[model samples]
Target: MSFYHNRLLEQDYYPVVRFYYYKEWEGFNMPNHSHEAIEIMYCLSGSCLIEVDGTTHKLKKGQFIFIDGDVPHRLFVEPGKSCRMSNIEFHFEELETVFPSFRHLVSEHEALRMLTESPKSYLLFHDSSDVFQCLNALILELDRKEDESVFTEQLLLGQLFIRMAELAAKQQNDTSEQHVYIQKSIEYMHQNYDRDIRVKDVADAVHLHPGYLHRIFKKAMGTSVNGYLINHRITKAKELLKRTNITITEIPHYIGMNSQQYFSTIFRQQTGSTPKQYRRESRYTDSRTVRSEHFKQQAK
Candidate 1:
């Protein structure tokens, strides 16, 4: 008996799933190695470290790293710490297939294009989407190897790629948005620092809720909104004291404070000097500079 099959045509793009596994490690280390397949290591619990090309990245719970093909890397779990992770390794090959390839998908999805075209050898991301579920499903299907499993596996893999790409893109967008909001808040503070402005006024200018603005501002600026405002006022007061012969009592009003005593207390706390003492010291330094210049001109 003889068997006959149709000839396979060349495909522009097709993904080949090499292998995948879920593993737990404790104080386990893998030496640097490279493979032809791209890989993803997703942490489910605890944490681990991934060293790639001399840079070490801490992969905590819910985070994952996507490493490109032929990139040398290794995983290390510290002593007394354990990490559970799901990993999938895959590569592309040219073959006949009905499914969409990553190249083709990139044309339709800007996020996917960025993911594939990024110059970084590896990308780390925190997963908040269905990426884990899809990856687990693909692993299960691959292990089954039952009839019709191939189609299901391909579909799940495609979903996984799209999900991861979207997650990375969302993270980038969120970071960019936060940066813009922070810059706007700082600009608002600088512009209105000489007024009796409250945190709510700054929030209102940025169209953000006061509490939300406070959280992000502190996170980005390392100080609260009110703290930044007070610091700015003190800075302006210092400049006025040093460069101008402004009255010590009027410095508070110039910097938006009505109570001279309160201003003095805060200034002392920040600069370790009372306003009067600072003014006196500044004048003494100026007189010394003038005398030195006169001596130099006389010598010439």
Candidate 2:
């Protein structure tokens, strides 16, 4: 069974980017699945083809493809070639918060506007492009697996997004100066949600009062700060329940909730099922889908 995990920068709701570099020796077949993040896959070597919404795109060495979030896609390599690629996944909604100018660029520029407004399955880039360099560096940093500074990582991420956004804005484009106070609060909320964090704590992180932060977060994200926090925690809990073998009782602790009773109440309210029920239904659905696909492939 294959599942796609959405990785992000620890503690930030905005632009949680995950980087991966994979070398598939006998080639690989990633079954069709959809995710909530835009994915950029770059071929460092070898070759493969990606099928999205029934269209097949040939990706060769020195080329890459940017797939929009929530698009179902699958990848496969031809019989002889091995494949090495860098995969970057991130939420597109974070683009506006992370790069304040991104929305403007999308509105003003025709190519970028089209891409954003009506995203295709993917956009292709060549090795010589500036975006490629930024992606390559980010991948290398992620692969190192060390105690790298978050500031440095954020800078690189900012640079990469800026270049890609700006490049799309015209040719192809800060971290600190652009972030609004509410964005900072959102980041804090994301980072500390698994703790016993409160609105005051989030406000203090950005030097604002609790009430003021509440208003701003509500206006910006259309939910109260606490509401956002609970929603985020519930989302994380759902992911864990669906993807992991952890017991339902342990899930509350994992998500920083105080008790299983509260977790079950909230889970049932939000998802219309208890955690165990949800997990069982989800696993059953996945297995059925997998079996159906297997039969189809065999018939073909």
The estimated TM-scores of all candidates read: 0.75, 0.43
CA lDDT, every model vs. true structure: 0.82, 0.70
Which candidate has the top score in TM-score? Answer: 1
Candidate 2 lDDT: 0.70
Relative to the unseen true structure, what is the Cα RMSD of model 1?
A: 7.0
Q: Candidate 1: misplaced stretches above 4 Å?
A: 1-11, 27-36, 49-60, 70-79, 146-151, 256-300
Please write out the lDDT profile of model 2 over residues 11-104, one tens digit for every residue: 2233446646555644577788888777888887788988886788889887787777778898988777787877888653333243333344
Q: What's the CA error at residue 151 for candidate 2, in Å?
A: 2.8
Q: Compared with the true structure, what per-residue lDDT tens digits does model 1 show for residues 1-300?
A: 000001101224555688888899999989889888888999999999999978999999888998887889999999999999999888765655577655566667777777766657788998884888888888888888867534566678778888988998998898789889989988998988777789999999989999999898898889998998899999999899999977989888888888898999999999999988888898899999999999999999
Worst 10 residues of 1 by lDDT: 1-10
Name the lDDT value of residue 195 in candidate 2.
85
Clashes of each: 0, 7
